[model samples]
Target: MDDTSNQEAYDRIARIAQEVFDMPVVLITFMDGHRQWFKSHLGTDRRENTPDQSFCRVPIATGKTTVVENALGDDRFCGLNDVVDGPGLRFYAGAPLMTHDGFAVGTLCLFDIKQRSFAPEQVRMLEDLAALVMIQVKSDRDIGRVDPLTRLPNRIQFLLSLQDMVRADPGRTCWIVLVDVIDNRNANDVIGALGIDFYNEQVRHAATILKRHLPGNTVYHVGGAYLAFMLDGAQDTPHALIEQLDTDLREPLVTSRGIPSALNPCFGIRSAGLMEMSSPDVLRTVLSAAREARLSERLFATYNSDHDDAQKRMYSLLSDLPEALRSQKQLYLVYQPRIDVASRRCIAAEALLRWNHPIWGPVSPAELFPLVDKTGLIHEVTDWVMRNVLRQIAAWKAAGIDLTVSFNISSKNLFEDDLVSRLSEVLDATGVDPKRLEIEVVEDMNLDNSHIAFSRLSAIRDLGITVAIDDFGSGYSNLAYLLSLPATTLKIDRSLVAQALTDHNAAVTVPTVIKLGHDLGYHMVAEGVELPETFEQLRQWGCDEVQGYLFGRPMEPKAFESWLAASNKALLASA
Candidate 1:
C-alpha cells in the first residue's frame, strides 16, 4: 500500500472508472505478488492480466458483484471463444474490487458490447463509484476508514457493522442511533441561494430516512454532520427507528425561499452488550452515547475513543478543500475598515474572507463560507474573490488608498448570466475602478424569488459594481421587498444595528429603515458600529455609512496600510 499510496489509489481508480462508467474502458488489475499488473487503463486492453487465466478470477469467485449479461449465455465465457466470440464480448458489469481489509482484491468491472440495461441510477453510480475506490484505498492505507463526505460508511463503518452484529447475535442488545445537522450554517444562510440544494437534499433526505425506517444491517454517513445506524437487534426497534428518522429529516423542504428550512437533528442512543466492548469499543459507546445526546440538542458534537480527532481533524480539513481551491491553497484576503461617517476616514474596505489554514488556524467567513457555498466551491471561491478584489483595488490605487473596497458578493453570485459579463472581465482585467469596486449582497435572497431577485440585482447594477443590501433587516421579506432592488446601498443590519439604542421599537425601526432608505434613492449604511452612541446614532439618522468593530477590526494588508496611516492622523486631529 505504498508506492506513493499505490500510485494514489491507482489514480483514484482510473479517475472514477472514466467518470462513472461513460466508460471508454478502464482497468486496475493488481493481483501482483505474482502476476496481474495494469494499475489503470481506459478503453482497450494494452494486455497484462495473464498468470493463469485472470479476468480477475470472476471477481475472486463471486464473493459478490459480477455481472456479464450476454457474454453469450456466460458458460465461464464459453472457453473464451476468441475473447467472447470474435470481439463481441456483449454487455457487462462487475463489482468485487474490494480491499480495505475484506479483500476480494480486484475488479471494478465494466465493459460493454452495447446490449444495454444499466439504470438503477446506473447501478448506484457503479456502486458509488466502487465506494469511491474503496475510499481511496482506505485513505491511502492509513485507514481513517471512510466518510470523506458521503463516500458513506465510517467510524470504520460503525466498527465493521458492529463486528458483524456481534459475530451474528452472540446475545442481542445492539442499538446505536446517532443523527446530525443543526445550524447547518445558519439554516444555510436563511434559505437563499437554494441553501446548497437544500443541504444536499437534506443529506440525501437523511440517508433516505435511514434506509426507509431502519431495520438496518448498518447505515453510516459519519463525517461532520453524523448519521450512523445499527439498530435491528429489535426490541421496540431502536426507539421506533429513532422516531422515524427524527420525523423524516425534520420535514420542511419546499423552496423558492419562503424560508421553511427543516432538519434539526441530534440523537444518541446506545446499548451494546455481547460481552461489553470491542466493535471499536461498541462504536465508541454509541459515539459516547451520541455525545450525551448532543448535550440535549445544543447543535451536535459527539464522539468517543476519547475526543481528540476533532471530527477526524474536520474530516482531514474537509478533504483538502478541493486541493485548497485547486492549489491556490488556503486562499487569502482581509480588509474590513469601512468608516466614512461624514469622513471619519477609512472610506471603504469590507472584503474580509480568510482561510490561510495550511494547518487550521484562521478559517472563518463563518467556517469556509458554507464550505464554499456547499462545494460548488462558490464559483471558484467567487473567482478567487473577484480576482483578488480586483487586485486589491489595483493595490489600493498604487498606494493612494482612495478607498472604496467592499466585496462580499453571494446571492449565489447573481445567478451568473455572465454576471455582468464576468464583472466586466474583472474590471477589464484589474485596472480596478468599477467605481472602486463595492459589491456586498448577502441579505440571503429569494425574497419569494422576487423576480429572481430583481434579475440578479439588475445584472449587478450593470457591473458598475457598488451594489450593497447585505443583511439589511435580516431578510424574511426584507422590508416588504425593498423596491425590487437595483441596490445602490442599504446595509442597515447588524440585527438592526445591535438594536438601536436599546430598542424603543428598535429606535423606531432604525429611523424607519433610514427614512425608507432615504425615500428610495437608497444609501443608508449603518452596519455594526460598536458604540459612540452607535456612531452618533448613525450620524443622526441620515446614515450614509458606518461599518463595525467600531470602525476597525478586519485588518491586515500590512494592518490595512497601518490603519490607513493612523486613519489619516485621526482625521486631521478631528478637524
Candidate 2:
C-alpha cells in the first residue's frame, strides 16, 4: 500500500486496541535521528515519549515488538524498569513501526496495569497503528517547516537557511526585525470574550500581508503579539523594513461584516555589526526594543540602555496594577458636572477616573487609563466606580437632590453579554432607581458592529437610565456608526470645545455638531467649556447641555452636595 493509506491502518489499530484491551493510551512512534518521536497518540498524551536511553530503544534497534506484563520482574526490562515501577504505570506493550522501504522505525504501543493477558485483536491493532505512524512521518519529512498561523516558513527553516548562507560566507550580516501589537489587553477588553481570537487573526492577517511584501524571509510568533523577521543581505535597510512593516500592519483589518478595527504595531530593528551579537541575541534585542518602543508610545525605538529603565518601570507598573486595584493603592474616582444648557443648571455628573499614586500624587488619565487598560483592570475599576457612584447617588437622594450621575464605560463593559444584567443586579443590590443613573460610552465603542453592545445599551436605556456618547470628535467621523448607536446624548469632546471661542474650525464644529445632533433628535452636551464664552457659544449653537470648569470643577461628593444645597437655598431666597 501507498504511504497515504497508513492513516486508515492507524485508525483501524486504534479501534481494535480500544475494543480489545479497553485501554485509552495508544501511540505509534518512528525512530528518527536520536529520538523515537510519535506520529500519533490516541487517548494518550500527545508526543509523550521515553528517552532513547531507555528500554524502548532495543525494540526499534532490533526491528521487533516487545510486551512486558510487569517490568519490575521481567528480566529483559528489569535493569532499567523504574519508569514502569514508577507511579501510574504497570503493564507495557510495543510494536515496531515499519517504513514502506521495510525499515523498522519505532513502535505502536499500549500501556496498562492490573497484569492482563494480551488479546489477538489488540496485537493486530498495535501493528496497524505502527504502520500508520510510519506513513505520517514520511509525509511530514517531505514538507518544509511552515507556521501553523500564516503557513509561512517558520524560524526553524529560516535558521537552517541562514546556516547555509553562513557556510557560503562566514562574514554574512543579518538583520532581525521584531513587530509587536501594542495594548492587547485593551484590544481584548474592547473585543470582549472573543478578543484573543480576534487578536490572533489580526496577527495572522498582518503576517500574511507582510510576507507578500517581504523578500525571502520567515516570520515567527516568538511570544504573544510578537513576530520576528530575519532578513538576509542588504536589500532592505532597517528603517525601510520598519516603514514597510508599519504600513502593512497599520492597515485596518475589517471583519467580513465590514466593521473596521485598528491594530497599532511597534517595530524594532537590530542589524549585525553593532555589538557583534549572535542571531539569537539579535532577535532578543530587537524584541526588547520593540517592547520598549511600545512602552514609550512611539512608532519604534532602537535598543539602548536607557530604554531598559523605562521597560523595567512599565512592566513594574503593569505587574502591580492588579494588586493595586484589588487593594487601596491606586484606584479611585472623580465626579464632573453635566449642566443643562438652557438654564445653565447642573442636572447630572459624569464620573472621571483618578489614580492616587502613592508617590506621584496624581497620575493623569492619559497615563493611568492606558495602564489600567493594559492590565485588564478596566472592569475592576469600572465596577468600583459603579458601586461607589450608586452609594454616593443614594446619599445625594437622601439629601433632597434628585440629580443623575453618569460614569464612562469601557467598550468591554458595553458588549459584556452580562453587562446590563450585571448592572441590573447591582441596582437591585443598591436599590438605586436605574432611571436616575446615566451611562456614557466612548464615541468609538468599536463593538465590531455586534448588536450585543447596541442591545445592551438599549436595555440600559430601557431601564429609564440615560446614555450618552462620551468624548465625541476624539474618534474618526463614522456618521452611520453614530446614528446606529443607542445613545440619547452626544457630548462634544474637550478638544473641540476648548477651541470653540477662538478657532474658526472649532466654532464651525460646535454648531455643526449641535445641528447634526438636533437633526438626529438627540441631545447635545459640550465638554470642556472652561471659559464662560465657550459655554455661551454652546448654548447659542442650540446644544442642549454643557459640562466643564466654567460651571464648576469636579468635586468630592460631599463638596458637590454642599454646593448643590447652597445653590438651592440661594434660588429659594431669590424667589
Give the Cα lDDT of each candidate: 0.68, 0.71
Candidate 1 vs. true structure, TM-score: 0.29
What's the C-alpha lDDT at position 281 in model 1?
50
Give the top-scoring candidate (TM-score).
Answer: 2
Candidate no. 2 TM-score: 0.57
Model 2, residue 448: C-alpha shift (Å): 7.1
Model 1, residue 395: C-alpha shift (Å): 21
Question: Which stretch of 10 consecutive residues in model 2 shows the poorest summed lDDT?
Answer: 273-282
- Every model's TM-score: 0.29, 0.57
**Cα lDDT tens digits for candidate 1, 103-122:** 77666667666655676677
Q: How many backbone clashes does candidate 1 have?
A: 4
